[model samples]
Target: MSTFYDCLLTGTFVFPLLGSLVLALSYGRLSERASATVGVASIGLAALCTLWVGFAFVDQGKAAQTLTLWHWISVGDFQPTVGLMLDGLSMTMLGVITGVGFFIHLFAAWYMRGEEGITRFFCHMNLFVFSMILLVLGDNLLLLYFGWEGVGLCSYLLIGYYYRTPANGWAAFKAFVITRTGDVFLAIGMFLLFTQLGSLNIQTLLARAPEWWSDGGLMPQLTALMLLGGAVGKSAQLPLQTWLADAMAGPTPVSALIHAATMVTAGVYLIARMNGIFLMAPDVLLLVGIVGAVTLVIAGFAALAQTDIKRVLAYSTMSQIGYMFLALGIGAFDAAIFHLMIHAFFKALLFLSAGSVIVCTHHEQDMRKLGGLWKKLPLTYAGFVVGGAALAALPLVTAGFYSKDAILVSALVSGHDVLMLAGLLGALLTSVYTMRLILGTFHGAPKSDHAREAEAGKGLVHGLPLIVLIVMSTAIGAQIHPPLDEVLPPSVHGEGFGVDLVEGVAMIVAVGGVLFALWLFTRQRGLVRRAVADPRGARLWQFWHNAWGFDALYDWLFVRPYRELVRVNRGDWINTICNVAPWLARLSHDGLRRTQTGRLRHYAFSMVLGSTLLLLFLLVG
Candidate 1:
């Protein structure tokens, strides 16, 4: 017998999965409208299922439950189960994955209406949801890794959906290969945990982790660092952080899904879910904060130099994820996940609206070539503003402010003043880049004749999800009480002036950054344009524009060396030896050719010589 919650939990991932199967099976059989309807309906059902399960879980007192389905593997004393788990953490992740995922799917339905192979696009997107659900719901590390690898595969496929372009394929491969490095680390960490403690069951692992290893033990630190490696790759943290920006070659919907709701969030979820293990390695945890803080600053400035609209959002995504990492590092687990949720809304909103703008402007993404779109697409413009405000963490109004303030305060409380200051600086940079993004497209004079007024009848469908996201982004902070409070670390302070002062300073810095961007890019464009055109500013521009030359550095270091090795071993040295064996046989046959040149004479002479030798031996004997 199963509870109603069980049914809903199973159906959450299943609904979209079934939808994906339907799309994949029908292939060319279904009409565009039918495919779109199925695509949207399937995800909508999944979202509904998530809502129902979440309600039941909450109503039942949010008591964590691990529902095991069956024995997954057995090797005499070692077995892991395959099942779903529900708690504050998984539920929050579920809501965001399916909820925001639903809207993104719907938005894509409209955004990708006219394209050939639209069914395939929806199919991949649905599959992504299913994979992500499995990831968040799985009750054990192995199952989570299954979902982990699943999304990576789907990401590669979706990112390279436009397979005609070589660049798209390359981008997809780059994402796949780079993230695989992190996966290797994750696998090693999993192996380490299992061999050390003999169980990977989430409850068992979490329960026994601290007992099995001392806080400063070598094995615990190594395991924690290895897991961090995987998280860094998946979440696109520093060093492994370069792949995410290039992932913008994907469709706007794919970008939104990958950046906002699914792939990037997995890393944050990983650390938060395994907080016990991390707590054993405080230095590693502190390193997490450092990585996050550094990445946020890097990404913020990188966003400033981006020319492509999606790239700006792409870098912004990296920077935001960095904030989550910082939070996790400082033991602000709940705040990290909380920010993860709010970021999903606002970031998805921005990407979706960016899609609308791109579609209306005839696929124009370069902001310098885009201008005066606020009047052209007022709804999209409004959604962009909402998302931008949240992204910029605009004081008390936006959701980002609420969540980000939590992180900054947590940093300070955790005795990470340097990290706290870095975060504030990143927030300021966030404000600047976000304003630059908004004004560059909406305020400047029309840069191209392609920009035109959007038709409500046709364009309104695309804006549907944007509106929902806008509302969520603006209002979600109000309801962020116990739902977000349960899974994270306890607050470092009660309601006090200290919290208020931190909030106030964050607000002022945020506002200052936005004002500065507005002044420079709009009112003072004439004055600053010349400076940017000057040698020093030009150098700065190139540095940020090229993502601080990380890509070039990687190419020179890893890519070129690998390519050179491939060239050197192009024939495969082992295979070359095999090639020589055949060549020698041919050479020996050629050497024997002369012996057989005159067949009759050669044969007769050989026989006579053999007979004569035999006779001589017989006579001597």
Candidate 2:
């Protein structure tokens, strides 16, 4: 039985990796259908294996298990194993990665049809799945970081899949550099753990952390703060969040995979996985809550001003992740994971549905050019409604309400009143922007020729994934919960505010925001136009539209200064010093060329002369 469990767990990640290898090797040789089949089938098989493992884990009562495949490193007291762990937390991540990833892969078949480099696309996608799986399942920090860096590499490749486009390449580069900054912080934190606690094995380090830092001093605080820095960058929280809106340069499937199932959620997983270390550093944890609150509100406002459909969703992804971070900050780890799972469903649905609309409109993604799509694309329209409602946390019907309400209630019970109010404000902003997105894309008359001639996607490949996701974005999917009580800290539940009052207030705020957006966009659009026409309103819109000028601020602070330094020193003494080795190599090559005469006589003379000199020198010695 143990062997069977081990094989299932191993195969869950291996299948996708194997598929990636086969697709990568067979690039340009395989048919499009063959590539798609391999990509989808690999994740499909992974999903099946995950289901088997998940059911077994739950049925057996959420017992934590570990399988050390082999030793990774051994140097005296420092040894970390190549290990895999199966527990409630990993189980939840497995289900999200494989299950949502499978549907995204399936939908990509239809979305990417007739596009160039189909095999390469599938190769990157499969590799991404494998990396995220390793990240969640690895038992040691070293193995987890291996997967973490692998994910960054795959994200770069996948984001710049359209390599001919310079803008996409830059976007990929930005994401790579920004995320690596965080990875460095994470590496430093790991080094501190190994130096202080003497283990890189996660469970061991976590067990030993309390013994070493039970007093909540500087060392634990510094380590936790460093880990939070890594999380902030990877999760697209404040300051590091400028990369994500540009990340929409990737294909829609890549966005769905990254935003919903894999990359953005990695930080949440890290914090939750290392809850023990964080508990000792109370100040850092509070900072985590502040970061989430600030990021969510900022992202929500930025989302409101987006003209591009995908960009709106991109900012929405950031804001939603902020909610997860908020849950983590307030010690509601289970609520955070629950929301992560729920967000995976609805966000994937939203992205794929948006992809469908993009395809139907001949690649037109500007919401300004889209309208009256509901009648023409009923299935896609239904997907957006359900997915958007879930995103907005619409009352009792959507999965998001249950999960997000859990976070909010946890906040109130934990006595973080300001953060709770920030969450509420974020919820209001979420509803308003989500409604505006829906209305701007589907409600009004056709705004351009693309919308007028838009063709709804056809066949099962297009419809099946959306249908499945729509179901998962509802209350029905909310019923299926991760058995996380044993894995994470239990959610904070007490008597600060009546749970009913909180729910009712949250419900009203959410519905009111949607209604307010409806009236503004639908009934009083002229007033909206007039407001934008005003200079002050226009300036405010532009400010929010540019994501509060973060990109520009970063450009001024880092990019411009670095470029200026390079320009000034382009031909300085440093360049001369750097060129010395190359100059010597060139001189030696010229001298050697003179001796390499293209004649047998010259070669023979040189060899004989060299041999005589060698013999003379040896005799003298």
The estimated TM-scores of all candidates read: 0.91, 0.97
Worst 10 residues of 1 by lDDT: 452-461
Most lDDT-accurate candidate? 2
Q: How do the residues 1-621 of candidate 1 rate in per-residue lDDT, one tens digit apiece?
A: 147678878889988899999999995688888888888899899899888877777777888877877899988988777889888889889999998998998888788878888889888889999999999899889999999999999999999999899999999999999999999999999999999988887778877888888997898899999999999999999989998988988889999999989999999999988888998999899899899999999999999999898999999999999999999888888888889989998999999989888888888888888888887688889988999999999977788888899899988777788998999999999999999999988876888776544333254557679888898888564365536555556656435686678788999999999999888888888887887899999999989999899999999999999999988887897979889989999999998786786678879998999999999999999
Model 2, span 415-488: residue lDDT tens? 88888899999999999999999999998899999999999899898999999999999999899898898889
User: For each candidate, what is the lDDT?
Assistant: 0.88, 0.93
lDDT of 1 at 596: 80
What is candidate 1's CA lDDT for residue 397?
A: 77
Scored by lDDT, model 1 comes in at 0.88
Those runs of model 2 whose alpha carbons end farther than 4 Å from true positions after fitting are 495-497, 568-575, 594-601, 615-621
